[model samples]
Target chain A: MVAIADSVPKPVARFRFILDRRNVLGSIMIAPAILYVLLLVGVPFLMAVYYSLSAYTIYDPSWSFVGLANFEDVVQDPVFQQTLYNTFIFTFGSQMLGLILGKFGALVLLRPFPGRKFVRALVILPWAVPIALATVAWQWMFDSLYSVINWTLIALGVVTRSQAPNWLGTPHLAMLSVIVVNAWRFFPFAIVIFLAGITAVPQDVLDAATVDGAGFWRRNYQIIMPMILPIVAIGLVFGIVFTFTDLSIVFLMTMGGPVGATSVLGFAGFQTGIVSGDVSHGAAISLFMLPVLFIVVVAMLRFIRRREV
Target chain B: MGSGGNKNNRSVTRRSFLKASGAIGGAAGLAPVLSAPFVSRAVADNKSLSIVQWSHFVPAYDTWFDKFAKDWGDKNKIAVTVDHVPVQDVPARAAAEVSAQSGHDLFGFNGSGGAHLYRKFFINLADLVKETEKKFGQVTTIGKQLGYNADDGSWSAFPDFYINFPGMYQKSLWDGIGMKPDTWDNLRIGGAKLKAKGKPVGISLGHSNDPSTTWRGLLWSYGGAIQDAAGKKVVLDSKEAIEAAKFVAALYKEAMTPEVLSWNDSSNNQYLASGVASYIVNPISAYRTIQQSNKKLADDIFVIEPPKGPAKQIMGAASEFYGIWKFAKNKEAALEFLKYYRDHWPEAFKASEGYNNPCFANLVPKPMPILANDPTSTPPTKMAILQDSDKWSAIPGYPGPATPATDEIYYAFILNDMMTKTATGQSSAEDSVKMATQRCEAIFRKWARRT
Candidate 1:
């Protein structure tokens, strides 16, 4: 009876066996995701590239190939040049502040303590809340005339009526204020990532370091930092991307002002391309950030993969 | 065994049929998705006109506008939907519409400049303008400049109204300083004294419509025009322009606090109503807001003529326009509605609490009942200045035509930045003017070359 059963044909089973190969199965599983990216991301990016090269406005469907004219306009214009500098300042400033604040927060929370969960919850508020709501609230807090901070300072006799600082008025102060607000909103995310990385550090290794008379600073600087380097690198990459392309905070707070002092490339692009009716020029301005971002992401990805290996 | 084998075969065939049916249904789903536009077009062909506008600062204005449109729709057997969004978001929303190439049939912008910005997307309304003007007198000088393109003689929009920007000041504060702020110098003098008394002047230096209005008034008074009368060349680098820049900077330093640097359109209203500032250059809406929020403060609020400069006293206002998009399914109905509304301007103007100043001079009658007596205003004549705003008021690119280029400069807050940069001491007045001139030139060149 067993030999007779084995002689039966199974055409469906043979076809299934071919599809079940690892490479074929993997590709089939990811087909939907790949198609989604192609339709949404790839096509739009290509359209943007085309728009940047050609004379195109939203109203017109036709385009005459203007070559590098938009890019030329962008490069020669002093406003776009300032925007590039501004993007660098905002991204670098906010990311550095976020990393430092996040590490400090994670280290403190890493320790066993009371209300630790509650403290962590409060720390997560900025990350949990919506960006627009949080940034608008910050705008009120940093008002030029009625700043709550200045009111507090005046109450404490720290400053007089005329001596109070204008947080978002002066150019440098406006840039600083935006960076601080941005860092405040983003550091919670970094802290969460760093906390997980810190927990992954081996307990035996820390105990061994303590046994060797390693002090607190030595343990963190020499031992823990190197151990979390890969994770730190990932966090830095995320912070850089987020800060570089950030739109809401700068737009809401200073509107890239006190004389376009706070206008990053993203906000400038929106103004030029969409609001001011210079779409191709806007695309060109935005594309300037791509190569630098790509290189940074690729380098970080390789570093991540090497560590994993 | 035969019966069991038959049952298994039937189940397999049934499962395969279900699988094929599911696949076919999924593929068919894409058909509707692809043909959605055509179907919508068919459905909307007979649909009533739709309008999108800024929610008026005065709640009553919206109530009046919405009801008026609905009534007109009822008479014409059309369904009218008026969607009022916040004024600040009007530009972004317009941009979104331009990008999608689909939106409200009749979109209303807070300022006339928006029509110029997206001129290509609008229907040519030259004939409609001529018809409306014949019914109502010649549309005011501003009405033509705001709604029509000079080069092609095409009307891109129909000018609906203009909101006035007058001097809104605290009566007691001004009396104490013994200054009426009748001149630009008087504002600076009074504002400085008031600042020392702990209540500074409130005028925005940020990217806001109010700032653009205020600065333009100053620039125009100083004989500084953004462009020549033809709107062809950049002329912001004049000696008068630099003088205006310096004067504004001195005012900022001596009188206003840094708060003005961050003020949005509503911030000054809030500041004045909060009693933190002695004076704010704004529309009468600020005083009205105070009337609702604080009656005591509202009583003290008095609006006078806009401070004068050596050149002239120009009210920096952009006429609000209602434009019909070329892609509109109901352009014929939209044009009909617009003509009817303008024909019935008297009722609309009175209903808007004088918030909607008429574009046609024929609409303003002698003894202008609304301005002479207002139940909401402290003094009956407090709002009278608004009735005559058309006399002194001119849009941003005054002396020159309000072209797309001028509108772009206003929308971009170009003048606001120049004033702010100088005020904050980031750039010298001369240097700021030079930079602004360069920017204005580039913008002019872009639009000039395009046309």
Candidate 2:
């Protein structure tokens, strides 16, 4: 009787009796989520693949199959090449900086302090503020002529008005400025995650390290880090994906300028596809993200699973 | 008997309303494809028009336009709605409307770029333009260059107004240096001296509309043309074009601040209004803004025609276009409204505080008291030099028409990229011009085939 009930279709089988099989109940519970993913991620991703194989314009309805040509055009263009280089640099630079800074902030906040709650909120403010508004403010702060940073530097005699650096004008500096903004925005979330991971370490484990005379760095790198390797991996995965695909900072601040030195994959795709109206080429540029991000996610997941094992 | 209450009456009223709506929808669906706007309005029984326009930089202009539109609607018994969005987001919103096949009957673009790109989606206004032109004196030649499409012999959009892209300078700054900001060379040289004093020129080199307008003036003045007069060939690789690039590189290094590489449409205005910039290439709006905040600076500031390059006295202008969408729901009303607006534009010009320069000959150099002496300027002759800008200025595609090809160049900001590349020394002037020529040719070829 039970076997017969299990073999029945889910909707029909559900009312016949209370679901006994864990697998069946779980599948039924997750069906809506599976459908959501299929409709949202799977559909758009498939559409992107199709678009990358065609020549499409945003203003026109007609398109033709020119298989792999869009990909070739994207890969061969010098500006696009620079954008690819910039994407990796930005993602890696921001991720490493964010991780280090976040870890430091979390450790400090973990200790007892005055107004810790308010301090925690302050640490999270960069992440909490709307990115568009934040980036616009940053754009002004980095302005070549009116930058407060330049004013401060001038006051300190570190730089003169004529010698002041144009934060978003020089190519390398523009890339660095974008990465700095991205890192600052991203580190708050990292801080929260690290805080949770640090708190999760068993009292005994920390005590063991303490009794063993481990320094703060030693404890963080050796005992605490190993114990929270899985959590760190998760944080890194989210940070990498967010940093890799970030468009707002570069778009609002530099607009991928200084000869596209600050152009990341996301901004380049937007400029080429949306602004320029070459939708297919933009899809191709966007699709490059898939393979790179997929590998990152998979590798991090695998590393976490290995740690668990 | 008493239970026969208001519920039944409400239900009956709703049924009647739905039936009327259904009939209207049915008729509208079957109307001539080109007359979608008219058919929809006809079945609705009430004359209502909707419009979308930029939240104008000069906020007072919005105040005037909205009040005037509402008053007109009241007199004509037509309900009118005007929606405003930030200027930069206009194209996306318009594109969304086109995709949805439903939106305001009329939309405005500050430049002809988006209008030309979405040519297939705009109503042909040739008849309307001709009538308006006949009534008002003919639109300035720049207006014809922007709105008239030779491909279909139709006005893809109606030209309404133009803004002169001239140099606005601080008189005291120039005086202190024993010079005047008259020519491009003078600007570069005098500007360098001022930069040493911590005030630099603020012409944009970013991917924004200003650079497209400002640099074209520079490019044209240097005998450089992005394309030949035919609009069919790429002519951006000439020595003239390279000279333009080389000159800009020197200016970028010596006179202009590097912050211009990241400027948005509003940045230069801020730079100038804050007293950090000695001169900028902009319309009179910036000076007007400064006047309200800093009458002292406003008194010190003066306007001049765009400095001459090596070639001639060709200034750049951004011609605003009024495009009624083909899918608009109130086409007849919208067109009528445009005719009224065009004939009544002098009033708008006054309301814009002399910022709205009319596209017709007679409408301009108007005896409007505001022009003779704007309350916003110290000298009162603040607008005098700008009166005859039509005599010297050209739109984006000067040598050529402002075709979809040129529109692409403007929208993608290929000219800005070329300038940025040359200015930043990422590529030599010759290499940058070559690159720009190649890119421009690709765009022109793509659109040419379609046309």
Candidate 3:
């Protein structure tokens, strides 16, 4: 016969017992992250919405309600409309260029070439570098006076010194230049996504396609691409969100210059709200991005859900 | 046998140790949390002052300023913190501070200061301005226009220094071309000739302070005004403005490269210093920068008054001023520091190498020491032309106080864009004027309602 104390089971500590509940433990683990998002992101987002509907400004920190007046003003302004159009063009143009570059990059990196690891690291440098730092470097490269590209073109005798293009000055070229920098910045991330999606396509499927006499291009286009469509679409969605809301590239490179030719929503919002101290209109300009962003996110997510095999 | 028994009694388990340590840590942390308020209050009341201003365009000025501030703090028995933000980021940083209702005690503004924009957030510096005036004659006209609020008859901020916008020209380049950019017609004709030879005059047309100031000078010299003298009306749609816009367009086509459309405040400096630009309208900082880096290039650079327009020769000046925040913790200390800084204005002027002109009439009296006797300048009298810069200098809301609406228009880059659009062939001069007028009216109406 065992003693009474030895026969009974040991009591767990109260804290441990509480933590043993899955719900309690899960909530405790995620509490900080949830709190951070709520306080930093959610609160500011709600404040922005409130500001959009009010006559708030840095000078006059009042919250007197103004209804849709700010939005109405923004809509009527031709510059805001131009900015909206530019944002779309910048987003889609850069996305297409980035995706194409990324796809080709993935194909090239898929092979087991010598020094593959070094090459891969070099390829990721653009995305790995901070955006502002990279953009500043690009700004110098596209500089009106000191652009290396123009210097090279002139040295090659392809263009005369007088004919060297003002990369950030001409309206069309300014837009193109910003798009190229942004695409270059983004292609590395796109390549990573492409590689992951492409790698996920099994050897079995490729072997089957090969046995069925599918050439390399046919195999990639018909068999593997269909399976990786969901991932690629998801990547494109992220690219859209990022490129659409970007401020650094446009701000540092062109400053929406040559007369608002390259102005995007983000930079415009900054110019109006922060620089000009007109918080209400700035908030309104920023909120204009939400509907489009929401639609793209939701549509892409739905597509991803349906296409996932 | 007795030592082993004692060791066994003294040994502690991990859990028991942790429990004891946790109690000790809790008490240690609780002491600070409990006393933080009282300690902060004590520090705020009499011990610390903070200052935030732009990183000066001239690096040496910032070096001198930081040391001066530190020495002052040491003498005063206060812990002083000075933060230098980039010029472009100043407005946004100030907005953030105002929004949070907390930040540095002394806020410095470059170029017109925008005291009118955030007047409510700043304490009225009338007494301080009056006291300074007693010591050093009356503040200059443009200084009053920049800092004084006519509505309440208060000086919302204290004018510190004014940066005169003179034409910085590559003397060798202009000499080779046999032209002097003393008048608008001469700049156009001579600039066209120079551009044909692959060297162009570079006045910024970008959305930067340089362009903003340059265009206003042009507008004013052409007899155009953004607002009437009373600062109560938008007069940007005048025939003179249309002519000014057209003149810029012709200048862009005939005399300037598209590069001017992309220049920032520093670009013109870089262009002229690189020995490429024939002429640019800017402060003396550009020449000073060359003086530091390349003495030979500095020798070739010369200063002249802004080009003469048909109507007048007025040019816009960049103004620097300081304001004490109403919510500042150590207001008295901040005021004291300003007073100290004010008393030593001549030293500040020397540190800036005469780039900063005193706003007070008598602080650095006639023949202005630095401008009169400069070792670095090519002739050692190259900068003496700036002695009468105040005569040609006009604030942004010219002929009137720079009001909140004018401040808004300035920050929004309305005038800059109007000139840019017309120059770039994006819009007709008339259309650009119309668009700018509409924008100005909208801003004016918004700000007018508050007044």
Evaluate every candidate with DockQ and list the scores. 0.41, 0.25, 0.49
Error of 3 at B37 (Å): 22
Clashing pairs in 2: none
How good is the docking of model 3, by CAPRI class? Answer: acceptable
Ranking by TM-score: 3, 1, 2
lDDT of 3 by residue, A239-274 (tens): 999888899998888788767889999999998888
User: Per-residue CA lDDT of candidate 2, range B1-451, in tens?
Assistant: 2233444444556578999999999888865776877768565547799989988777999999999888888778799999889876776677678768888899887666566667788889889877876777787888878778766788878888887777888889889999887888998999999999988999988767788898998999999888788677878889998999999999999998677887767788889898989999887788878888998888888888888776798778877788998888889989989988887888888877767777777765455557676665677777677777788788888877777678767766778888888888888998999988887887777665445
Which is better, 1 or 3, measured by TM-score? Answer: 3
DockQ-best of 2 and 3: 3
Least well predicted 10-residue stretch by lDDT in candidate 1 chain B: B1-10
The candidates, ranked best first by lDDT, are: 3, 1, 2
Best DockQ goes to which candidate?
A: 3
Error of 1 at A255 (Å): 0.9
How close to the true structure is residue B23 of candidate 3, measured as C-alpha lDDT?
A: 99
Query: What lDDT score is found at residue B7 in candidate 1?
Result: 42
Error of 3 at B252 (Å): 1.8
TM-score of chain B of each: 0.87, 0.87, 0.89
lDDT over C-alpha atoms for residue B342 of model 3 = 96
